[model samples]
Target: MRLASLSLRYKILDFLYKVYPEAVEELTIIHVFYEYHTVDDIKKHLNYLVDKGYIEQKEICLRLGTKKTTNIYKITSKGIDLMQGIIQDKAIPIPEDE
Candidate 1:
């Protein structure tokens, strides 16, 4: 993992650790924490985490008489290991521009 990934991973793990089982919007995460990250970038990183088996996404439907759906993210034990420095990281990277 690069520093950029590590940073985002840390932030996300911290967030999910603080609010497990509760859904949070990607926009809300960008607005509140990763101010410099775009939704696309965040989504890409999340996809990476998913591919790496560090987190899981739950697609839920709303019951407002509509077909609306929401994507809620949750961290896995592997992700917690990485966040806690149990997983080795690779080269360092910088924060990207939105």
Candidate 2:
């Protein structure tokens, strides 16, 4: 079954936050481990993060008698702030819902 966009987004966040510091590649086998079928879905979430200023992207072209485009991704300061917020929020004790 396909994962929800929210789940995918969190998985992405966890990946970038803990697993891979350099999660720049357009296609990653590790994404499949996180239940991503293709790069398009992952790219969609990455674009959303970029639009929200939680991340940044850089385009690098390869020349080998042909042009190849690759996207390089990096978590921005805003993303680090977001992560810290999440950590703090999780640290606070809250009553469990019955």
Candidate 3:
């Protein structure tokens, strides 16, 4: 899929790709804000990535006493390949001077 057309999805995938190795430990509420526009937007974007096979979702228990469930996402190999292709293709536009 075209990265520009899938801008939001790509952003989510990029975040997942960056955090895949330490996803369980590094991801946090604050990180979402630093990386994305909003929580609901990120959620919707991640859902699209999940549907497209770019990301895998897992439910992890964050607390022992209550077994609080948290959603953790990781990028697939296919996602990395796609991201590399997009980067190589250089499909993103450079802004023009106003």
Candidate 4:
């Protein structure tokens, strides 16, 4: 899938993986995108991540008297291994000043 080729998906997956232990509140993703995009963009990107199996979906109740609807992503082990390789392969070593 071309979706697998996009770097943005990787970024989103990395973010989710890093935050998986936390609650991953909805607003957290919005804050992550504040500099360049809107919350809608993040939501769309998250949907793509869901389709790619890098993230999971779950309904969450954000408030009382409202139907619970949210995508809670849990990073898969395969995703962790993939991200680790990507990070390692792309890392650039910094030189120390003598």
Candidate 5:
């Protein structure tokens, strides 16, 4: 089932949090949400998190015959704080399970 945008963003954050210091490629994130969301949907949420400083984004460029770019995402301290309820945002509706 498709989740609301807010819920999707929350899920993205939670998933990233589970990996902590390890950064995940955009493709991996797409796989996680593919059943419920589109690539564009996942990218939009990822960009939003980067803009809000909740996550850090890195782009790696690879060259073989053509240039290819991959986006890697990792949760920031602010993101961890948000997950821990140390900070709150009206945009992300985090659950109170922690």
Candidate 6:
């Protein structure tokens, strides 16, 4: 379970890194992993990233028709550093291909 959680976190960071500077909607992130993980599981990993200062989360309100609030996540400088090997977290193992 612990390994799985770490892998999920790493993948989340990787995805966010690939799209750096662009925030991803919560639903979109969840949808990407819906086949193997529950919404709650994906949320938990997102929260973990936020708490670690590796990612930033913000709530955006859309007024298209009605007021709708949603979360958007983006990787932070620290997260980029981790991806670049300037910093490291044992839990999130760096991928070799990177």
Best-fitting candidate, scored by TM-score: 6
**Candidate 2 residue lDDT tens string, 1-98:** 23365556555655566644675555552355445345676777778877877677887776666689777777777666666664322322222330
Model 6 quality (TM-score):
0.91
lDDT by residue for model 4 (1-98), tens = 34333545666666776776554655666677656666676777777666655566676876788986664566666556556664222221111230
Could you tally the backbone clashes for each prediction? 0, 0, 0, 0, 0, 0
What order do you get sorting by lDDT, best first? 6, 5, 1, 3, 2, 4
Clash pairs (backbone) in predicted model 2: none
Local distance difference test scores for all models? 0.65, 0.59, 0.60, 0.59, 0.91, 0.92
Error of 4 at 16 (Å): 1.8
lDDT of 2: 0.59
Model 6, 1-98: lDDT tens per residue?
Answer: 57887889998999999998899999999999888888898999999999999999999886666788899999999999998999989988887788
Candidate 5 weakest ten by summed lDDT: 59-68
lDDT of 3 at 82: 70
Tell me the spans in candidate 5 whose CA falls farther than 4 Å from its real position: 1-3, 62-66
Task: Estimate the TM-score of every prediction.
Answer: 0.69, 0.64, 0.65, 0.62, 0.89, 0.91
Question: Which stretches of model 3 miss by more than 4 angstroms?
Answer: 1-5, 24-30, 34-36, 86-98
Q: After superposition on all CA atoms, what RMSD does each candidate show versus the true structure?
A: 5.4, 6.1, 5.7, 6.5, 2.6, 1.5
Per-residue alpha-carbon lDDT of candidate 5 for residues 2-92, written as tens digits (9 for 90 to 100): 3498999899999999999899999999999989888898999999999999999998875667679889999999999999899999889
**Candidate 1 C-alpha lDDT tens digits along 1-98:** 45665677556666775676565665566666557666776787777767777778777775677898877778788766665667744521223341
Candidate 3 worst ten-residue window by lDDT? 89-98
Model 6 lDDT on a 0 to 1 scale: 0.92
